[model samples]
Target: MQNSILLTGATGFVGGAILNRLHHEKKHSVVAVIRGDSHLQMQNVPTVRIGTFDSDTQWKENLVGSDVIIHSAARVHVMNDTEANPLAAFRKVNVEGTLNLARQAAASGVRRFIFISSIKVNGEGTTLGTAYNADDAPAPVDPYGISKMEAEQGLRKLAEETTMEVVIIRPVLVYGPGVKANFLSMMRWLNKGIPLPFGAIYNSRSLVALDNLVDLVLTCINHPAAANQTFLVSDGEDLSTTELLSKMANALHKPARLIPVPCWVLQGGAALLGKNGLSQRLCGSLRVDITKTRNLLGWTPPVSVDEALAATALHFQEHQ
Candidate 1:
């Protein structure tokens, strides 16, 4: 469909990728809302500057003539949050802020609102043989997850009260292009031939390529089936920690050197070192079933995991 769309978080990995695709496709009139001081200058894609995204952020003039608003902006999880009340800090931007934006967009005549929520809304990790789906009740653990769950609840209530259609997408770890944090660190360590203890990690996890997620977002722009539905997304393939490392090694053209350390031993060591969370992320299972996403929208991830990993490795090499 050819319609005007307003996008938030244009400076982020996910939002930036979406903006680049929209600019390349030229299928819709696009408006990117970003931080006021951000020096992001893109050709063709117009931008609106909102200094800070919170409950008070303005959007009437910006949302004008926009039929769709892709709300990809959020306050991501912090490893070391210094706030006295971390939940309140997260609520300011993630819950209250998100609802504020949605309320304004609905009032401004926006037809559809696509919210980029996190898989954490389901929980941190799943049992080895189990995966999360939209039917599962939200089991948010930390402040970040709790905040996202609240925002999603608010959005659904808003949708019931307004004319706007809401599409919620909860994706597993998103990787590719300008990836950072744990994914980048993993690649860097692998490239330097760092022998990892994940050789024996038999746990499974899922990831989504940036291209795949952006493609799904674009599809939701007009697909009636996606409206007012929550989707759990992944790469359609689950890999153990060892398998993921091996794939990364292959993509980076490096030999994998892994130690067959016992999972219990690693967990015990991590507990002693106060890194249990880190160990769990490496050794536990967290997967999502996207069968509904595929069946409802007839959409498939265009980029294969191996191809996405190769492209990510290439980008890392060039940047380094």
Candidate 2:
């Protein structure tokens, strides 16, 4: 069902991808909330420029009569040791900012609030051979994850108190064109012909392509099965680090220079460099069960990992 949707984080990576999909499909009239200087990117869309997050985005009025509220803005960082209060900084945007927008949406009588949360809320993706599902208890380990978990609770509570239906989506490691962080790092490494030592590793990890995630988000916006439910999503396929890198190299038409370094030795070396945590994160298992999303909404990821990787490789080849 086409509806008026208030899309936050329209300038961000995943959110931008969602916006592009929505526009091309012409499924929703989007009211994009963006920063003042970032208005250039929202040229053809109805937009509102806001400078702060404290109950003053002026986008609230736009939320009136909207069908869905896709809240995608958040404070995301792998590591944060800045002198500033970390929890407060994240809470301000992730929790408080979210509440502010949610409150407005509720007050505006929006139908559903679709929150794009991270899998970190479930905790570090270790504990190999185990997959996290929607019903599993939340065990967030980092400040960011904690804040997101808190926000989830707040949204649930708000839903009980208001008319808005909340659809919480926990996506694990999303990748596509315009990817960043570890995905970009891997791309650069492969592009430079660097031999990575991940060939010997065989830990399974789950990832979601941007298009797959966008499709699920669209489903959450209107599907009856998604109303007031939490879901975990992935590409519906698991790939080990070696398989991932090899596929990436193949997509880039570069030789897969993967060395056969033993996992224990790599872990020990990382431990000596005070990067044992990095070792755990990079080589750990993070499989997620996406059965609920598929069975409930009758949705499926539209692209294979190979196709997604090829698209990303082409994107980098054109832009970088």
Candidate 3:
């Protein structure tokens, strides 16, 4: 069945992908909430521009008859530091803004609220071989993660109090076309033919393709099994750092320039500079188990990591 959907973060990566998919499928009436003027890609879609997150604007009125609410907006990283009170900034939008909209949604009779949360809510770094599942407790390590974790908690509590069904999806390291930040940085390194010293690092981490994530979001929007559940989703397969770079090279149609460098030596260098913390994230193994998601929702990621990498490479090539 088709329904009107209220979506936030329409200008963002994941949100934009879902919007495109919805348009292509002709599934629903989309009301996009953007902070500013709609991007060229979103200009044709109906939108409500509100500069402030806490504004009790008439946007809620649009949600009166909406079937689902997908909250995707969050203050992503501008840099790698806790320069100011990051938790405060994250809360201003992630926590408070979320509740403000959710409360209004429930009041307006929206049935389901789908939250796009990060896996960082589980923890910052990872343990080798072991992977985090849906049953694990949240132990957010950073300000951003803490804000998301708090939002999840608050939303769950609100769901218990109201008729709104809240579905939380935690995705890890989503990468695809038009991706920026760490993903783009890695692409740059590969494109430039830079020889990486991570050949010996064998750490497996789960990743989700943009298309696969979009598929999951669409399913959660209306699936009966998705109501009031927290699901950890991924591509189902994990990839080592060396294997990932190799796949990337293949996608770019370039030769791998990977060199074997012991993990201990890299850690030693980072320790000297007091940046051992970063080394953990860069070379750490962070895998997610999506068994529960499949069993419950009867869903799986649609794209393989290889296909995702190929698509990303083609996109970058066109842009370049």
TM-scores, all models, native as reference: 0.98, 0.96, 0.96
Q: What is candidate 3's local distance difference test score?
A: 0.86
The order by descending lDDT is 1, 3, 2
Candidate 2 Cα lDDT to native = 0.86
Candidate 3 lDDT over residue span 1-320, tens digit each: 78889888988999988888887788788888788665637457888777788524445566868888999888875556665788888888888888888888888889999999999899865688799998799989878899899899999999999999999999998899999887888888999999998899888888999999889999998889999999998999898888999999999998889999988888888889888666786688889999999999999788998999999999988998
Task: List per-prediction Cα lDDT, in the order shown.
Answer: 0.92, 0.86, 0.86
Instruction: Look at candidate 2 and give me any clashing residue pairs.
Output: none
Model 1 lDDT at residue 101: 92
**What's the CA error at residue 294 for candidate 1, in Å?**
0.8
Residue 311 of model 1, lDDT score:
97
lDDT minimum window of 10 residues, candidate 2: 53-62
Better of 1 and 3 by TM-score: 1
**Per-residue lDDT of model 2, residues 120-145, tens digit only:** 89988856778999979999987899
Please list the residue runs of candidate 3 whose C-alpha ends up more than 4 Å from where it truly belongs after superposition.
Answer: 38-40, 55-58, 81-83
State residue 225's C-alpha deviation in candidate 1, in Å.
0.4
**Candidates 1 and 3, the one with greater lDDT:** 1
Worst 10 residues of 3 by lDDT: 54-63
lDDT tens digits, residue span 1-57, model 1: 798999999988999999999998989989898886874557666889888889998
The better candidate by TM-score, 1 or 2, is: 1
